[model samples]
Target: MQKNSGKSVLLLFILLIVSTLSAGCTDNSSTSQTIQTSEETSTRTLTDALGRTVEIPESVDYVICSGVGSLRYLTYLEAQDKIIGVERSETTNSASNAKPYSLANPQFSTDYPVFGETRGMDDPEKILSLDPLPEVIIKTYSATGFDPVELQEKTGIPVVIVNTGDLADNKEDLYESLRIIGEVVGKEERAEEVISFFDENIADLKERIADIPEEDKPTCYVGGIGRAGGPQGFQSTEPTYPPFLFTNAINVAYGDMDINVADVSKEKIIEWDPEIIFLDLNTIECGEDRSGLRLLQNDESYRQLQAVQSGNVYGVLPFNQYATNFGSVLADSYFAGKTLYPDKFEDVDLENKTIEIYTFLVCKGDEELGREIYNTMINVYGTPAFAKLDI
Candidate 1:
């Protein structure tokens, strides 16, 4: 029995030594293979939707954005270094109010350098001629107003398309678009993280407001422009587009009107008599700096409306919020929600929202961007009720 025990101990000792040696050899082999693969891994090249087969650095370095919506998504990815240029019109001095605030960090537009404005997308010669060509050009589907394939042939730069425009009906399609941007920017983890955050927060918001009585839901009107000459002050009958429909308020316009937008008379608005009126701030007055309420007050015909009397006129910045584009609409939704339900959303800080939006949608830093966004909001909507509550 003693002899058998000694033999078993020796066998175990030998097996332990063998295992250690095997592990050491495996580690060395893996290290060698990794080094070899790194040397052999060439930069990948692919043909984007634009039909241009462009080569990209194994590490994507620069991205040039052409439209607002695509820029917002790229900023959210935290892939700012990838941005090389942007359309000049995005930086128009007269149209500084155009950038959407809610879903963007200020850095996206203010910090990043602009190449030139995209006056017309069909002129590929202009985009291609810009100094320091970009590795990727992110564009919106409808805004670019050009066939992507043709553009690619002219510029020889790959184009990535992100549908930031809420043209998609539901949230699932929206997330899918995020995933696509993630794949393009090589930030899949960040994309998923952002998508998850949006889902969780939105779900929480729905739950928080779900138990509230329907009777308590605020009656709101949303429209593209403010008409002061109407019998009622400002009409609250805008269609449920990107931002306004996502808010906590009930859309009075959608509920009561069969608006074809072809021939909406001023008298029709007086019939609705909305409690709240939200208008496109940028497009109002044929071009003027005034709130929707002010417009109603200035016009002699609108003295009878409840909205103007109650001071419930809300202004939506058209350059950013009303634009049927990517980040613009998302920002519009965030701002619209907060504006509609200030009491319930008081805790939902815009700063944090701005940062998250910049990270998730704009993919950029959250610096001066917040201030710029706030400024745009103030210009469009007037200072929040809280700002003047002390007075």
Candidate 2:
């Protein structure tokens, strides 16, 4: 009976040992699975602000700017090296910054040579004719009928829609747009630099104007005086346009002024009779040198206005830097301060400020030219318009 009991105990011990080995193997297998899951999640792809799911590529090299001015930011960030192609307009001699650079250095725009204008984003056939595919397409939009989603569906390439509404409203949108583009193009650091420069300059301009009293703030007006392509000179009196919004100054014609931009009649302008006139260089008078602004200043009907007498009128030419020209917001602010208390900003230097904005937007740093554009007009229209409008 004792020998049989001892044998049973030894059998029980062997069974226990086998059970322990099996449990250990199961635990190790589970740990291995958890580690594999973590690795996969780390590399997982995500969607961007434009609502497109983009996988972070091992490296992003080739790029194409789908809409106008998209390439300007890319070039500003120094990421032009990664661009494979750009719209024909972007490569044109008329495009200012990009054109001169592209001409001097063939390599400037030739990384990938794309032919055709910037207006054909929806033309898949034209895009396809380019043959080689771009990994990404960046575009801008307003109320236009061309749907970005449809374009994406037509072409296998992913389309990222950038909302340009902010260009007409606030500064936050500008920074946000930059960050989104940077992420798409893998130029995050460069984007941050551009944003920082914009923020710092804006802050400085505000600081200089803070001491002025609210009652004394200069009343201001911002708009484009001449249309470049129109058979007759064009007046962009529309309150919703870029020149008005980016300037951040009060538009005399915006709220109760009853001005019609589409009709673009000088009769409409005479009724508004804004104290401070801001001219867009592309206006009908573009090639006429200061002719557009001069016409408005010398027009017999406008001679009685305080602005024409005091020299408060100014003109800003549209280009990559001023093309979007958020700096005009600061220009508006500085001009307002000077009008309110000429003594305070006497040393503030509007000319220098103009240069700073141009420099920030493009490497050309045309400070003198910026001052020249403003002075040529401001001298003609006097300061009363700038003074009468509360900025």
Candidate 3:
């Protein structure tokens, strides 16, 4: 009887030991599987706009934009929600906020932190010091003097390069940049929507003006092109101005200089004597009394020009604000077409057109915003000055 009882006790002890070993193995296997899954899901490799291979977070929720137009591109992609910081210029300059992107994303003005010195001038130390450090950094190809690879090495963070090209002539580059940004933020569909919008608008504009004879197109000149906050005088102009190019207007300033934005002599402007003149509203916004309109209103040489004498001088919304407000560019094209050839755009509703553009670009269709933009471009203190003969 004692031996049988001892045998039963030994059998129970062996069963308990087996049970303990099985539980330990199960727990360890679960831990190993969890670790492996985490490792697999944490990161992914992608080719950026510059074609550089980078391993970025699989779920990117935080990023920093570095360069002149990088933030603007991100805004277009509707990924501003992921932006953790901005350049100091974005916070300091109230005028910069006048851009449609800024209007749409007010959080940039109120809540986000400022890290870099300014657009295109990144400070690595400041970037590293950001609390809850960003997951990735996206910079314009020509943004900073520092090497992007070096930056990645120093910070141990993936750096992606995007090219924010001249939107007026480099639509391909813009589309590529948008796609790259979308890929990073997982907004590929949104990027395609933006590209489609651009494509449709440009194609429609081309179709509308395709049959207009070149000789019938009015000779046009744009002045008061702003640079670094100060307005250029009457002679300052863009040779490849998008508004002029897209609307099929004869840009008298085209090929006048080798540079994109150049200042020509007043005599040279008079020599060209374009039939229509577009004044950039930036000078008036600057309040520095350096506007082309101020010169046209004050100077006899400008007043004697045929376009001004004929009341063909028109106001165009500032396009260069915070690196080319693309909405403003398309809007300016419509207004230019209307002013140059009223009969061509007679059926077009300017207010509705502006709202449509703002809606697509900034995702805002607020009537008040559209009205403000319209007023800023066409009216001076409630007086309609677009194409008006008298200054």
- TM-scores of the candidates are 0.66, 0.65, 0.88
Candidate 1: TM-score? 0.66
Provide the lowest-lDDT 10-residue window in model 1.
382-391
Off by over 4 Å in 1: 1-58, 95-122, 142-144, 167-173, 224-237, 241-244, 255-257, 261-264, 283-285, 288-291, 315-372, 380-391
The true-versus-predicted C-alpha distance at residue 263 of model 2, in Å, is 6.2
Looking at model 1, residue 129 earns an lDDT score of 64
Tell me the tens digit of each residue's lDDT in model 3 across 88-140: 76675355346767766667767877777665577788779887788999888
Off by over 4 Å in 3: 1-37, 143-146, 228-230, 257-260, 285-289, 364-390
Better of 2 and 3 by lDDT: 3
- Assess each prediction's global lDDT (C-alpha) against the native: 0.55, 0.53, 0.77
Cα lDDT tens digits for candidate 2, 268-385: 6666666666554444333343345546655676555556666766544432221354444445556555654567667877667655654555444455544444443333223222
